[model samples]
Target: MANSLLKHPDFMRLWSAQIGSAFGSRITRTVLPIIAILLIDADPNEIAILSALSFAPGLIVAFFAGGFIDRNQKRPLLIVTDLVRAALIFSIPLAAFFGSITMMQLYIVAALVGAATALFQIADNAYLPRLVEKDQLVEANSKLESTDAVAEAAGPGIAGLLVSLVTAPVAMMVDGFTYLWSALMLTRIKKQEPEKQARDENDNLLSDAIAGLKACTNHPVVGPILAAETLLAFFGGTYLTLYMIVGLRTIGLDPFTLGVIISLGGVGGFLGAMAAAPMAQKLGLRTTLLITLALGQLSNFFIPLAAAMPEFGAAFLALQQIAGDIFMTIFVIQALSLRQRVMDENLLARANATFQLTTGIAVTISALLAGPLTIIFGIAPVLWGAAIGSMLALPIMWLAKEEKAA
Candidate 1:
C-alpha cells in the first residue's frame, strides 16, 4: 500500500508542495508572534488580536470562497493563492528593512494571508478527488499528513535559528521563499481540473452559501465530524496560547528548546500518519478515530502537569505533543477521506468550506479566551480545562454511531 501510494504522481506532486508550504507556515507561526511580542513590544491582548485576525478571515470568507472555488478549477486557485501569499510575505521583510513595520500592518497582512490560505485549502480539498483512485484516498491523505508532520517538526527549529541569526522580520523572508517554491512546484503539475459551468443570471450567492451549509449540517457523517473538530479546535487553540506562556516564561525554556520539543511532536505526527492506513485497516476508521480522539484528549492533561513539574517537564511535554500530533494526523486523514467519499463532487468545496468556517470560529474564540483564561485560571488550569473539554467530544463521537458504518 505504501509502495503504491508513493508511486502515484499526483500524490507526489501535491505532497511535495504541501510539505514546502507547511514548513513555511510553521516558520511564520513561530517567528510572527515572537516578532510581535518581543520586537514590536505588543501586549498580550494585542497578540491575541493578532492571532484572532489571522483566523477571523477564514470564518468570514469560507462560505463565499467555497462557492467561488466550486465555480472554478482547484489547481489555478491553489497557484494564485500561493503566489499572492508569497508576495504578501515578502512585503513583511521589505517593510521591516525600510523601518516601516507596525503592529497594525502586520495584523492586516496576517488577515489577508489567512484569507488566501482559506481559499487555497478549499480548492485543495476539492482537488484531491481528481488526483488518485478512490481506494487510495486514505493512504494518499496519510502521506500528505505525514509530510505536514515533518514540516511542523522541522520548521520551528529552523525558524528559531534564522531569527537568532538574522532577526525575526528577516526570518520571515525564508517563509516567503518557501511560498514561492510551492507556487513554482504547483505550476509544474499538469492535471486538468474540471471547470464549473456558469450559473443562472438570477442565482443568489447568499442562498447558495446557505444551501451548502444546510447540506453539511444535514449530512450524517460530516455533521458529527464538524462538531468534534470544532470542539477540538476551540480547546487546541486555548492550549496553544497557554503552552507558549508556560514554556517560555514560567519554565524558562528558550525558543530553541521549545522548537526542539515541538519538532519531537512532529516526529510522532509523522509516525501517526504513516500508521493511519494500517490502523484504519485493522481497527476500522470509526474505531481508529474513537481511540485516537480519546488518546488525544488524555494527552492534553499531561501538558499542564509537565509545566508544573520542571523536573522531567520537557520530556513529558514532548510526549504530550507527540501523542497529540499522532491523533491529529489520524483524525484529519479519516475525516478528510470520509468527506471526499461521501460528498458530491459539486458540493465538495462548499462542504469543506463549512468545515473550515467552524474550525476558524472555534480558533478565533479560543484565541480571544486564552488571555483572560490564563489570567484567571493560570496556565495549568487552562490546560487542564482544555483537556476536560476535549474529552467531552468523545461522548458526541460515541453517540453519533460512527463505528457502525465502519
Candidate 2:
C-alpha cells in the first residue's frame, strides 16, 4: 500500500517528465563524446579534460549550495536549471550551424551542464519526500529508479540511431529540447510546495553548510557510507574517464555498438533496483550496502583486464557493464534510504548537498588524476589503480555497525 506512489498525481507528473528527460540526458551523454571522438578527433587528454570540466563546479559550489537551497523555493531552481541547460545545450547546434563550433564550446557546455546537474539533483531529491508519505520513500525511489533504468537502457540505442542519422550536433538538439519539455512538465504540476524557512539574517552560510556535513559525518550509519561513497566516486571517476578511451581506441567498437553495450548495463541496474528493498529486508540495510560495494568494486577489476586482453575486451566490458550497474544501483538505493530514515526533514537538502560535495571532491581528484595517469602509464595501469583504491573503503564499511541514537 505504501509503495504505490505512482497513483499520486504529483508524483506521476514528476515521473512522466523524468522519463523524457532521462532518455534525452543519455543522448547528451553519448553524443558529446561521440562528437569529440568521431567528429573532432579529440585525443585521450582532451577527453579527460572534458570529463573534468563536466563535474568541476560541484566541487566548487556544492559545499555552500545546500544552505542557499534550504533558504529558498526549490521548484524555481529546478525549472531555471533545466531551461538554462536547454539553452547551453542548444548553443552547440547553433554554433555548428555557423561553422563556429569548437572543443572550447563543448568544454564550456559540459561544465555549465554539470553545475546545473548538481543543483537539480540536490533540490529534486529534497522535493520528492514532500510528494509522498514517509513509509513510501524506498518504494517511491525504487519506482523512479526502475523506470529510470528503462529509459537509460533505451537511451543509448536511441542516441546511437539518432546520431547515426543526423550526426552528433544536430541529433543532440533533441536533448536541449527535452530539457524545455521537462520545465514545461514542472509548470504543469500543481502540488503546493512547503513554504521555505526564512534564514536567520545573522547565520553564516558556511557554518550552516558545515552542520549538514557534521550530521552526515557524525551519524553512525552515514559516516562510513560517506567515506565509502567518496572513494567509490573517486575510483569510479577514474574508470569512467578511461572507459571510452579503452572502448574506442583499444577494443575498437563503433559508436552504435558501443551504445548497445552501454544500454545492456541498464538491464543490470533495472534488476538491481527491483531487488534493493528485498535485499535490505533480508541482509539488513547496512550489510546490503557493504556487499554491493564489494561486488561493484570487484566488477571494476574486470574492466582493465578486459582492455589488457583485447580478444576478450568486448566480452569483459559487457560483463562489467552489466555487473557494475547492478551492484552500484543496489548500493545507492539502500544507502540513500538510510539517510532519509535518519536525517531531519529540514536538513534533508543540506545533508544531500554535503553528500554531493564529498563525492564532488572525489570526482575532482579522479578527473585531475585520470588525464595525467592515463597519459603516462596508459589505461591498464590506471584502471588497476582505480580497482585497488576502491578497496580502501572496505575497512570503513566493516566498522560501520548501527548504533542506537540518543
Judge candidate 1 at residue 261 and give its lDDT. 86
Q: After superposition, how far is residue 348 of candidate 1 from its true place, in Å?
A: 1.3
Q: Where is model 2 poorest over a 10-residue stretch in terms of lDDT?
A: 397-406
User: For residues 147-238, what per-residue lDDT tens digits would candidate 1 score against the true structure?
Assistant: 88888777778888899999888888888988888887888877777767587566566865776788787887777887888898898888
lDDT per residue (tens digit) for residues 270-358 in model 2: 99888887777777766787789899888888888977997888888889989988988888877776677677777888899988888
Q: Show model 1 residue runs off by greater than 4 Å.
A: 33-48, 96-99, 164-170, 201-205, 249-252, 307-312, 373-379, 400-406
lDDT of each: 0.81, 0.81
Error of 1 at 60 (Å): 1.9
In angstroms, how far off is 184's CA in candidate 1?
Answer: 2.0
- Candidate 2: give the clashing pairs: none
